[model samples]
Target: MRGPHNIIRLIRTGATLERTGAMKVILDAYEAPRLLRMVVRGVVWPFQWLGMKGDTSMPPATRALTALGPAYIKFGQVLSTRPDVVGDELAVQLRVLQDKLPPFPIDVAKDSVRDALDVQVRDVFDEFSEPVAAASIAQVHKARLKETGEEVAVKVLRPGIEKAFQRDVDAFYFAADVIEFLSPASRRLRPRDVIAHFEGVVKGELDLRLESASASEFAANTVGDEGFRLPDVKWAYSGRRVMTMGWAEGVPLGDNDALDAAGHDRTRLGERVLQLFLSHALRDGFFHADMHQGNLKVAANGDIIAYDFGIMGYIDEYTRRVYAEILFGFIQRDYKRVAEVHFEAGYVPADRDVDEFARALRAVGEPIFGMDASHISMGRLLSYLFEVTERFGMETRTELILLQRTMVVVEGVARSLSPQLNIWDVAHPIVEDYIKTSIGPRAVLRDLAKTAAVMARFGPRLPGLVEAALIRQSEIEAPHNRGGHRKMWALMFLGGLVAGSGAVALAVVL
Candidate 1:
């Protein structure tokens, strides 16, 4: 039999606490019982005292976050967006938790590629060089195409990373459970659900096929955009553990001198990037979800070639319309309309006063809208929105928060390259276009056609539906269909027996 999950959770929390020492400090130095504080102090005080001798330049908080490993670092990235969670200053500090690791051995990388594709290394490529970039999940290397005499990049997964992540995730869930059980107030954040979401996304990232699919989908979505593009996947050399794609040619966006020297138009490039991202989000309802500078490249033809599509986002047409309305409302200074839209979307509680929420949103919008691009701050808007949401018992939407985080990062890059770039200016046209296209007469006709097709497909089921309704009406109105009741009861009994037997068989096989 499986052991109690709660027991595993306690061990994970204790281990995390011992390694990080934040919990000990929180309990001992901040609040709680004297006895418990003393116990924690006695346990963690030695580590604080004797762990480092000299020249430990990194701050205690930094060291603690690092000690927690990739899971914590990723958490730090998420927390950096939540000014409500860790406060602004702490969030800023946590944003620097870089995800860098030494490259795995070349032999290991080759072995992984061979095993995943069931082919020899020499047969796969003309030449493969050492790693050019290394990250938590995988590393990339420059390679030559065998048939076309072209250059490409080979991305290989880190060996045995899934096991390591699974172990840490097990520890994370355990801690989240104990926190929720011990503190009734902690459940509001849904810590366990947050951990589960992180697990799903990260585990998905470990699969190269999923990432390739994301890249292909994004490329298809934005193919019409003049200056936007995604790397073309090399299907012949891609699988679950390996990805090969066209090697983009451009200096990193971080290098100002190279960008200037290449005669690149920084302002135009910035505008195109902002517009492209908004189009992907608003027009298509599918986006890159991660658009940091490292994942973007400026082509010689001025196309922004996006890479590393491990994370993608999707929303239905209704949600996209609501999102566009929110943006358009904000642009028009129609806070009341914005509040009404949120209520209509079931984002805020129905009982909450729309006028009051609008006033709060106004407090966030008016000051920022008046400022220039350099002075405006999305982070402040987020803070106000979170505070407003908390008052109405609004829970977090993981996808929304991730979208916000990416927007902040993308806007930062735009401003760095072109300081006068206004995100609102770039987004307004795209949002307006989406609103016009989706809410006009054409959309109505299209939706009507779709409904007609669905009705035709279900036309045969109408008789069954009518007969079932009549039988229900007869039973309810008369209350004496003994023959029908007997037959129904007998059929239900047989169905239960069959279901139970199948379940038992499945259990045995598993």
Candidate 2:
């Protein structure tokens, strides 16, 4: 899959990292190939010795990644959460990579807004001020909309950051390709697919309109949800480069002094934060992945207002139901149910022993009993669970990793507010309620109704579907007897069987 140009580019990028001193990040023993890594370090050793290249002031691991640009900055953010791979010290330093960057010139910000909305600076905002915050991709400015005189925050992407990000993403793909080509050990991690996912997550942020839609969708999903809110996105003013949203006024979640002065109860607030995250993930199947203290604020009314929707996560309905049951099972101390959920989801291999998996889960769940928010370390639990998963041949679950990372960060945020907060007490009611609504008798009837609706629409087309398949099969067999026709006929037969079964089931149920 890789060509010579890719190999040349990788060497050049490696040189860039070496010069930046970011290459010094010590990796885990399992991260191969040792010869290649050693060759890189050896190649860069002279540069370090002569002090002729690279800035060594920062940690060796973070310096090079910081030099790479936004995509790699995101990689640093992820690495910060994976202490087992990068080591604790390096992970701590990598925290700075979480959207910490200098703001681009204010003139550039104005130009971006003007171009995106096709309006003059004064035409839209009555009072555009300096950027209050800046990150790897964009900077935020507080302004008053000219039409309504309403305060809103405007986010503008940096002028040339897009090109830099694209180049870095190409570099990532090149690296992934080389790894897959050279190292069999890395295939388990699925490096290329992982980079492809990273590509999506990073590039998605470039379009502010998409972010607005996501925020709107998230808000809709959390409608009637207590203690949390999302700012209304002003589509009229929002565009690819710029987004306008109602200004959220609140104390940062991490600001204890301000939180106390504002007459907010940290203990209760902490419980609300954790509850909101869990409910969004399991009940709604969507959530704000970047829940750092900076993105979360406690409003004067004690409502939590979330901002910065560029980075979001989602799961399907099936996964959502499974996640809910797993949490509920943990609450009920039913380890078998937790294990069953994993097996049913195919996260664990079917060949694995369910009882052994249950026992392993029990070991993880039992230790956290009676633990408060501070005492219950979700990260440690996940780490132990990961260890157990490896024994059972569980593959790397990329989607769930984002959820796990966010949960760990959120629990830390919650614990900071209420050291003695009983997470189990807060989570139990929510999980139990969701499971009840989504499982058992109510769930079966709901599923049947959905199935009937699907059949109602699809049943009429069954004959045509089969007929088309048969025609395709005949054409294929007449031309090329390459045995490809079997699939076409097999698909046709399956379609007919499904159509018949669905009609029969619907009639019997009615």
**Candidate 2 lDDT tens digits, 119-213:** 99899889999989988888999999999999999999889877877777777787777667766776766667667766777678888889989
- Number of clashes in every candidate structure? 1, 1
Candidate 2 stretches greater than 4 Å from native: 1-24, 48-59, 78-98, 178-184, 370-373, 463-510
Candidate 1 residue 202 Cα shift, in angstroms, is 1.3
Count of clashes in candidate 1: 1
Error of 2 at 465 (Å): 4.2
TM-score of 2: 0.86
Q: List the residue pairs that clash in candidate 2.
A: 22-64
lDDT of 2 at 462: 82
Candidate 1 residue runs with Cα over 4 Å from true position: 1-43, 46-62, 78-88, 476-510
TM-score of each: 0.84, 0.86
